[model samples]
Target: MTEKTAGKSLGVVGLAVFLSAALGYPVLIVAGRGLNPADGAVFLAFWGVVFGIGSALSPIEQEVSRLSAHADLRGGRVGPTALRTVAVAVIAVGVLGAVLALPPVAERIYSADDISLGLIALASSVAFALQFGTRGVLIGFREVKPYGGLLVTEAGVRILLLCALLVLGVTGLLPISVSVALGSFAFLPFLVKARKHVDFVGDAEPWSVVARRTLLLMLSAGLTASVLTGYPAVAKFFAAKEDLDALGSLFFALSLARVPLLLLSPVQAMAVPTVVRLLQDEDGHRRLVSLLIRGTLAAFVLAGLGGLAGWLIGPWGVRLLFGDQHVVAGWAVAGLVWSSVLLGAVLLLAAVLVARKQPGRVLLTWAVVAAMSVLVLAFTPGDMVLRSVFGLVVAPTVGVFVALGLVVRAGSRDTSVTG
Candidate 1:
């Protein structure tokens, strides 16, 4: 895409991200207030699993976006490739469903016998795949307006459904959970509209290549989500039984601290394409280096400010929103916010590595971070909240460094092609 076109896409997508972020809070607020502490804790764990899987499976979107953009450049159709991707995603979801259906896994994750949640989880997976696949198509074709609309629709419908449930006094876990799951499916109208786009029409990569690369991307995304979207659920496994009840506060604080990520998510969706476009430019390497330096600086500055705010306001913020039942210490809030900022930076760097076609490096980076976090969570001694905070703060710090190193090395060897 031309620089002017890129700028326009950024503006539209940025606005949509803003709207999505704003609309999203009501859903969280309602969820926090409507459920008692124990139920809220259970629901938060459920929320983490659903979103974590969605985030983990986001590679479908990323791969499709990358493939679609390259296909467009080659004057080829990515429609068939997109279809194959959906099939692979379906198969993956089937496996995921089976695992989640296990009594052991379901009992721990859901903390309730509600069989409906299992069904909702499966359905949500399908919706997540379709949602990401459709989004990939729009993004590949540079359909920013439609892309932006999809974002708003998903968030707006979620808030509306959740709020409606609240108004009806149906704040039980099942109803609210279903309401949350429906947000992924709210993109149906947008999907129909997406079908009319010309980009999904021609021949592209072989299925084997797509599947292999997609699996690698999925692995990387899964590890990343374990910390970002899935952390609460993952934490439940390692956290002492006594600490689990109190996790409601930590999870709430973490969610609030992650607001910036929600707002910045749309930008992340565009990261691979933006980096790919840069890689295709004549003076790409130097430009990529400059971008990395600036991005690192920006991440630190923004994180520093966010940490300060969390330290001062986050303690009272959760209390005000969810009552005294949930209260995270200010230091923990600040640390979580800092971790999120670093995680965002790591994601951007991973995009650069992906654009360079270095999936192994990306996978390796997240693996290290994930392992580090899990070890800390398992072995660290302290209050559960502090332990959680330390693990989160340390993991992403490692990811940013590892990913940056990988990106730099990849750039040094070859910036113009898959290395």
Candidate 2:
């Protein structure tokens, strides 16, 4: 089992690095164009929405699947039904956002948008939410090749579209946003084709029961999203009030630092179903949990080494990727990477909790973290970099450690009960 798990982990890791390179390079190029501090903030805000919605929807889908399984609904039908519901909700939100109420909200959040960025953000949000929910179905079915392929293809198409727009001198948030929506559209056919392989197209269970469970799951998932994406926005609040240049540097550093986490995502993706199955058997659960803790610790040590290397060589990398003018963002980049390692560990714990059906606990932990982040950002002063590092990194790191301890204790209690 260990050997098989290791082999699977290696394969997923390889796929992650491949996709990241394919996707990351183009994103870096697009990001390079936004050297202005305001542009940097906008870019971060766009991703904040995209990833925030994605993260928020993740565990909701998990809950949907769990409920569907319990109710004996077909896998194929369960996903499509939930996705259709979310897709409609997303579109409704977009349409409602067209009102003047949005600009004020954007302004309050320091995310001033021309009509184009707003519309683009709106469209991107719906597309992202739909794609994410469907992708969850694919993962639940264990259709990994198609799942990974869709991701790589989506990233490829996005890059192509973005590059085409840039070459035409139509570089702004609108075109990129449209490109994101289009890229999402490109994945629909693949999802349709993938759905044929899974049994997801039959009659679903009762909608009322499913809706009730999904809402609870949404709250949990939404809180997780807050920690992942809300932290950046919270940091942005403090960032905007301080030195703009420092804010830009922090954003750039943090963005670059996230690449390693992206590279590690496939591991977590595969880990989820694997852990879920392991938890069904007593000895298997114990073995799986032990391995996960050890594996996460090992990954962290490696990430720490990589972060140190980035700290040492990051300025040169930044210069090469962005420009010599942006070299000073390296230290923050290194710090951000180290923070991601911490975040990655927290994520692994979250996944374990989900597998154990304890997502509410995970949600509560994120609530505390998000609240702490807001407080720290609101109170901190001095350079934006220092403020951001403290609020986003220091506070979350503390929260994650506390969350990890709780999860470990919970797992132990669960084992005792089952034993």
Candidate 3:
């Protein structure tokens, strides 16, 4: 019965992850097929900023909900006071994003046309916050199926609209931006579903404690999320117009390489709740150690298999999907695939850390990674496009090491105590 319950839970999570990734993978393929290289660069760049904002808000969304649900299960709740705090935090972030999207600031991040679309995309960040916040509530309430459905609906709307635009020959940043904004609202229906979950976190910890923790996590983990989503834009800024096509092609390859993340993202929603629950039990640490080890192994295996697949057909894929200008070197594709494997491991490790209530380690990991990436972009003298791509490949190794160290330390700590 225990094994069966675990299996059923695994099956449900697996379904959600794959289903969430469905539209995303296809969207990348369709965009590659339809958009010109330069436009692809614009689209990818705009995507970085918008999604970065969304990712930034995700800590609040996922944590608040997970905590809310966890509290409820423990005879506590987040309550009206904390919920209001969440609201205030959302508004504050939204304002900041809006200000950053203004003309002067926008120019720093994008071309004039791209800036226009970037602003529109930024507008969608509010919707993103609302959607994710609600999702956290649903997650906390253990409405897993509904939570997963909302995930699919949000992504589905964007991809369907993008496909329609592609069919009509509207392959540019504007179409992409509009699709993002529209799709963000697709989760409105789920907000109501989450209402009961958010009603009152009974006997929960102090709102101040949760608020402080949420803010800290948002700053640390959010920064990492921002870098992952925003690097393409930053890379584009460093690249000359002559190099746009190459950057675009590299990004196209990156999108495919990161297909694993798309699959793992929703699956990770279960991580916090599961880890938190497990950690409270007598065998919590052992269970967490086992899960982390196996998950990391699985991530590495997938990386190897995915890398081999990429090496074989990656160049052919680029040419077929995005024309000859999009040809990626086989070695580069292989490196990126392995890097993605590292990335998946990093994400898993991050969840482990989060579950253990240690976000500082996650921040340290990203700080090192972000510094390396920025230095490479700013000072690595070479073809701008090539250098940026190299940085992307190298940065994940740092995460791998840091995550490995934490895993070992955690295991040792648990063993010393248990033994």
Candidate 4:
């Protein structure tokens, strides 16, 4: 049992991830049908902003988890370091939320009386910051059950709250949105329960160095979040007024296409350890390249199949699941699906880069892909669906090429891999 900690933890956490992701679809559907088209779109946009903020702050969790694990291995304490980091992260996110709540931004994102909504967003951001931090502490200590419990707890809380609101005949956008923010507090129970037993003692790094590394991670993650979780908010900003009505359908299609990403994104974490092991070998570079080449080929084939299915049944499926108001074109759905799979491929390559300790390349990959994708969305001469398709497709395609180029260049430096 002791020897199986890694595998067991991963299995538990993986199931938790799957369940949390699976719950998201139903939550989206309930929210979509619960509100009118315009309100549903607004809710989604708000959802994106809040969750995007959370995603941007996710690096703290990663950093803390890594630090905690290293600290435990070294027989040090990480409690003080983790607490300080969490404090900084929460404060930073709070400031960001405040900026978003400023009259101009708030008005655009929420109702005319947007103070309440903005406050909700701010609260949610802080909650998510703490949630991530706590989970990091749990997982870093190899407390997989606790970590998994937190994930399920948060999802369950959100869904139950949403259902309760609906049952009580409260379907207002603001009210519905509260469920999301409040759900993040699910970590509190777990945190309190294990506080005394948890060992947070760990060696501390210099504050400046820690801060710098965290900022870089946040920047890279922010870019990725802007492309993934934040795209809905992007669409709301760039879309023409006439196309606004169809925003619900566009968002619905986007969510459906992203279902695969939820499952595949976790693969990046799994790949990191494997890649690190490979890097220790004499012919590691060659082996890594060969492995990725095969993986890329598999990604392409799977993406092609997913795209075809999206083209064939994507529209019908959305209509059946979300209703006529959420109708989108098949080709656009196909593009979205294809883009998602490609992004998964990019994630795999990113794992390699991360394992190789090449932060610069990782940022470069996201930078190029994210910028180009936004540019395509903003300037493409077409309807919303066409623009979205082009934008989504451009992200992962460009990302794949850029990441591959970087990987190959890195491989070139190794004597084991002659190009």
Candidate 2's error at 53, in angstroms? 1.5
Runs off by more than 4 Å, candidate 1: 1-9, 66-78, 113-115, 142-144, 196-206, 263-305, 408-413, 416-419
- Tens digit of lDDT per residue, candidate 1, span 1-419? 78998888888988886887678677778877777766776677778778888887877887778767876787765667777786788678768866775666776666655556767877887788888888888888777888899989988888888768767879898888888889989779887666764344566578898788677667778898899878987776665546755787788888888877876777777888888787777778778888898889899899889899999999999889777778777888899999999988988888888778777787888999999899898899887777789999999988888888777776452644454
lDDT of each: 0.80, 0.61, 0.71, 0.80
Which one wins on lDDT?
4
lDDT of 4 by residue, 353-417 (tens): 88787888888888988898889978999787688778889888889988988897884324233
Clashes found in each candidate (C-alpha, N, C closer than 3 A): 1, 5, 6, 8
Can you write out model 3's per-residue Cα lDDT over 296-406, one digit (the tens) per residue?
A: 677777777877888888888878766676878887787677777777778777776766656667777777777777778878888966687678767877777777677
Best by TM-score: 4
Query: Deviation in angstroms for 212 in model 1?
Result: 1.1
- 26: Cα error in model 1, Å: 1.2
- Model 2, span 189-217: residue lDDT tens: 66675455434555554666555555555
Score every model by TM-score: 0.85, 0.77, 0.82, 0.92
The C-alpha stretches of model 4 lying farther than 4 A from their native spots are 74-76, 110-113, 197-204, 412-419
